[model samples]
Target chain A: MQGAITIEGVDKRYISRGRETVALDSVSLNIQPGELVSFVGPSGCGKSTLMNMIAGIVPMTNGRIIHNGKKVSGINRDVGYMTQADSVLPWRTVEKNVALPLEYRGVRTQERKQRVDEMLKLVELEGFNKSFPRELSGGMRKRVALAQMLAYSPNTLLLDEPFGALDAQLKMVMQQQLLNIWREQKKTIVLVTHDLSEAIAVSNRVVVLSGRPGRIKHIENIDIPHPRDVFKVRFLPEFERAYDSLWEQLSSEITKGESL
Target chain B: MQVDESAAVGTGLNTGGSSKAVLAYEAGLEQRKMMVRVSQVLFAIVFLSFWQWASGRIIDPFFVSSPLAVGGRLYEWTLNGQLWSHLSVTMLATAFGFFIGAGIGFALGLLFGKFAFLAEVMDPFITALYSIPKLALAPLFIIWFGIGIESKIAVSASIVFFVVFLNTFAGVRDVSQIYIHSTQIMGASNWAVLRTVVIPSATAWVITGLKVSVPYALVGTVIGEFMSSNRGIGYIIAQATGLFDTNSVFAGIVILMVVGAIINGLLKKTEGWLLRWKE
Candidate 1:
């Protein structure tokens, strides 16, 4: 009854300054409905490259990405893609920023205006609708970004380090907000991050990636309940075991990526 | 990254966020407070008083008119409506030149920005001519268009074109790659991407160019008028110089200065309205 994302043996490469570098190699995954999956590795791990493929920001080198049953070509409007930076335009008001997609899709003005109201209320940005991005705190801007992404009610949410810019405390708060939104909306969410603890905190399943031409080393399902408090659950034996297992499998690949 | 702002209602100050980013706010306030009203008034008073004292006691009136005499002549010319008609002529030439030049500059800038090949190929020629003194070509312009509005308009447009074109090109080229990637992921068509991302992002550059070109338009028109025209404030100054009518010369100079200030004010007002987001 719900949508799923299927990656079929995808490969990606980038040619920069006359050097051809393979980014992803024969990566395949099946993310089911209501799934919160995270990809974790060091820099240039191709976590971002894989996310770009699913989001269709970059063309696949040698594979197919299917959202639901149809093949994705360029960008998929039915999916929300959030990047590491630049999720908002500074010129747009906070409310206008949130309602950008709806505006672009040519939603009726009246209906869209009402949705803007609903969105601002949902993001707790009701009174700050007129405020610009520069006026808002870093945390507030991220919430606005999340609200904007949620406005279209996409079936899939692709996050590329949504909390990368925030401080540690702020990142925790954002993770909780994201968890709450997922609980209510039940969108199939895929997050890419370098932080191992963050990957385990909010995701239903954590996919560990080997650096450089990234491939999944391990996929560990948390089997934990929703709204899991990281502060309380993070210290448990199960969490420690899962973290070690991922580190053990990824340690060599991380070194390999760094040396190259 | 949701702020717990529900607890911060009516706080009146973002003390927490302000404390977190003091340098950004402090530098912003410093820029805003840079416009010194008192210094401006004092400088104006000192300059006029010095003009009056120097002309009345020591300096030759033929070279530098007294402030009082200049004021009186300005008052007389204004009452007879000579200044208004001349001001109107200058204004029309400036406005026409600015619009046409700015319009073309903006379009060409966008083209050059989007097409790197065109920019690379044409940039050398643009740079070579941009470095050349445009005023030297005034005689050619005068001979071609005659001593009329067209010559002034052509001069004004020529000077402003380089200023605006370069700015628009830089602005477009300066747009964040993040925005482009985000828009592409949003499924925006090429036209939509250009309209939403390219133009708005480059507007800051275009506005910067506009500020620089406002005075450029005036200088081009005034230079053209000085070279060949029989009307405008430039004509008044040129005529007054021959007769040693220092008061009239001073009056014309004062009129040009004030007119320049007023036009700058108008340009700033327009920029503020369009770029309220910066605030």
Candidate 2:
């Protein structure tokens, strides 16, 4: 019950320039505790919007989100959200950025340093502790971002295309690293991504959503065994079958979205 | 640029002076630095010599004021300690005005940035006030604040206010929504987010505004002094102009240039130290 998230009949409506825009409508989903679920959809699919609502960064217009049996309102401190863009503070060093959540929770300096050091080692950024974010490469910065998100040990993570900016090889490595961490911690994860293969490779369940006013179109269970080698997962027959089915559902929605 | 393999290898070595190549590279660099200094001195000498030679032949020495005459005036002012007193007075006015103006500007900028309705309501008035040539209001400031350092301070403060305010406002407004949302989701309260994220993010812009407004601050002080003042470099220049002492006028101008350059250099150093993380 620690990481269960129940999004019930959530709708998001935005009024911009006197025009009402329905971003998400009747989007209900139940995520089991410690489940790794990926939301795959086209652009403007309200995937990120749903993630924001679940994190309580944005409000749900019509319904509610419950996490761990408690209703989530403004600024859900129970979950950590890794944004698509680089959220690493340019002014802060890697250690400082990772230590931010701990500092917010009033963790003592000595304990904070220990945890930050451990997190840095986990992310393979141990030597770059004092280096500022601006001095880091894109992949290194992504690692720093991951370390920051995972530092305080949040029970749930909402990742929005976290590795979208990374190159193919680095993305695979990061995906593997993420899987390693998720397997160990068993934290509930909700990832919103445009890449269908990525969704299939990492998540236990891939939720495909339709275009604007986004609603769940299909949910596919990826029954691939644990300890997935993200680098070689595509070679597996089950992986191929899941990819084909998920691609079929996602591509049709994408085409429908395009025609509109 | 040629890739000097020996120099590159020399740079890679952690051992001190084990390689002859590093010594050669160091020597080359030293020579280049020396050459640059020599060129700079040579350029100054040529320019000053030309000015001295052309003073009487090409232009009227009385109007132009030869370099020697300007130097003589500078020495006389320095010997009498008038230069130090005037420079110190101007610096004090500039410093006080800059701090007060920048502080208020930064505070209001944050307030207006957070509240869109307030910014919108006062947008036109702020724009109108900023649009007026600040020097044009010097007479009015002189009247209101009297003919002392206070008038100069008022003038300099007005000049600095808009620059810092506009930059700080833009900096706050331009903070990415993603950063705010991410920080909020990470359990930072509104005040915490403002303190840790918003203010730090706007520091670069605020520093830039301060750097750009430095000359304007100086302008305000000098203009106020020119209009009416008892102790400032601008007062010296005004007095010299009234007496038609062109050499003293040039000398005052030289001191102003030196002061401006020194202030700019100090600002550059501060900016480097503050923004070293950027590198």
lDDT of each: 0.84, 0.88
Model 2 global lDDT (CA atoms, 0 to 1): 0.88
Task: Name the weakest run of 10 consecutive residues (lDDT summed) in model 2 chain B.
Answer: B1-10
Model 2 per-residue lDDT tens digits across residues B107-212 = 9988898899999999999999999998999999999999999999999999899999999999999888778887777778888789878888888898999998
TM-score of chain B of 1: 0.85
DockQ of each: 0.39, 0.41
Mind giving the per-residue lDDT tens digits that candidate 2 earns over A167-227? 7877888899989999999999999888888999999999988888799999999999898
**TM-score, candidate number 1:** 0.90
Residue-level lDDT for B187 in candidate 1: 59
- Backbone clashes in candidate 1 total 1
Candidate 1 chain B weakest ten by summed lDDT: B6-15
Model 2 ranges off by over 4 Å: A16-20, B1-34
